[model samples]
Target: MFPIRDHNPSGRVPYVTYTLLAVNIAVFLFYWFSLPSDFALAKFYYTWGVVPAWLMQGEGYSGLITHMFLHGGWMHLAGNMLFLWIFGDNLEDQMGHVGYLLFYLACGVLAALLQVAGDPSFDGPLIGASGAIAGVLGGYLVLFPRAKVDVLFIFVIFFRVFSISAWIVLGIWFAVQSFNGYAATDDGVAYLAHIGGFIAGAVLVLPVLMRRGGAGFWARNQGKPPHPAAEYPVTPSRIPRVPRR
Candidate 1:
């Protein structure tokens, strides 16, 4: 199951979020077309993507930032952008454009550092904006824990959409990442970076939360977005339901 959308909408357009999406897509297209072979693509990734060994060796310092824009495949780019699209605007709405952008970059860099620290010897390239997007999720959880997010759950032939609380969704996600990171699973995913980015995001947003009145913020908004929660018309699923034998 994955999130499809959220019931909370930002009060204003999130220009930074949109621009980040466009830039990531553009960068992916640029390398996808320019590179003719898998070898070349791998070489490009090594140069731009964060390699724990190189980074720990005090080299390729720029990869910490550049790596956030480099994605391994279309699905990687799509998944990260989708999360950003859903949760980023609200955080941007609270933090403002410049501040959100800085927060995103800082989270990405810190996440990379944690990943490097986790396995300083790993030589593979780590690429994607997931770490930064995870940061947005972290901030969203703190600011709007009760916001309703519509998640699409599919079990083989059966599929359904469920509107659940933000904390449950993000909380579960963080838990899974934490477990995987601690287990040191070889899934080629940077779970450590995700963990670090999430913590960094949550901590970074504390100032904003305090400005809004700390616990009073939660008391006032009741952990939901300040604006009226959006109501989506329930539409029947297109898939035909099969009768159980």
Candidate 2:
């Protein structure tokens, strides 16, 4: 199951979120297409992406922040940006542009540190905005547990969209990440980073929630977006009709 969208709409335009999307896409395109060779790309990633061992050695300390802006491929970039777009606007609305930006970066840094702690000896470069996005997911869960999120399920050719509670979607996602982090033996995916980022997001949002009246806030808003839900029109399919002979 993949999330298509959420019912919660931001009160104001999420300038930070939009800027982040554009910047990530632009950075990925520039590096992905302009790199001359695989070796050169590897070198570039080594410089920018997190290498736990290198970090432990007091080198590449900047990778924690740089890594989040880099992605492995189109799918990697697309997936992260999709999550950011869906969850980030509401967060930006609540935290304001500057505060939300700082929160995002803090979660990302903490996530990278946790990943490094998970296996400080591993030297492979870790890249992607997933850690930070996972943090956003955590924050969203805390602030909008009752909000509706539309998830698209695909099984072979069968396709369906289901509207479910944010808690369910985020809960399931956290469970999967936790299980994977425990069972993972390979270095390809940084499940630990995802876990760490999620925890950070959840914990970090608590202060804001408290200031907003905490349980009282939930009671008042019913854990939904403060603004009216945005309506999107479903477009008709454009398949051409076969003329009867």
The true-structure Cα RMSD of candidate 1 reads: 2.5
- Give the Cα lDDT of each candidate: 0.93, 0.92
lDDT of 1: 0.93
Give a tens-digit lDDT track for model 1, residues 28-147. Answer: 999999999999999999999899999888988899999999998989989999999999998999999999999999999989889999899999998999888888899999999998
Question: TM-score, each model?
Answer: 0.95, 0.94
lDDT of 2 by residue, 1-245 (tens): 98989987899999999999999999999999999999999999999999999999999988999999999988989999999999999999999999999999988999999999989999989999988998999999999898889999999999989989999999999999999889985748899999999999999999989988999989988998787876666788899888999
Where does candidate 1 stray beyond 4 Å? 236-245
* lDDT accuracy of residue 158 in candidate 1: 90
RMSD of each predicted structure: 2.5, 2.6
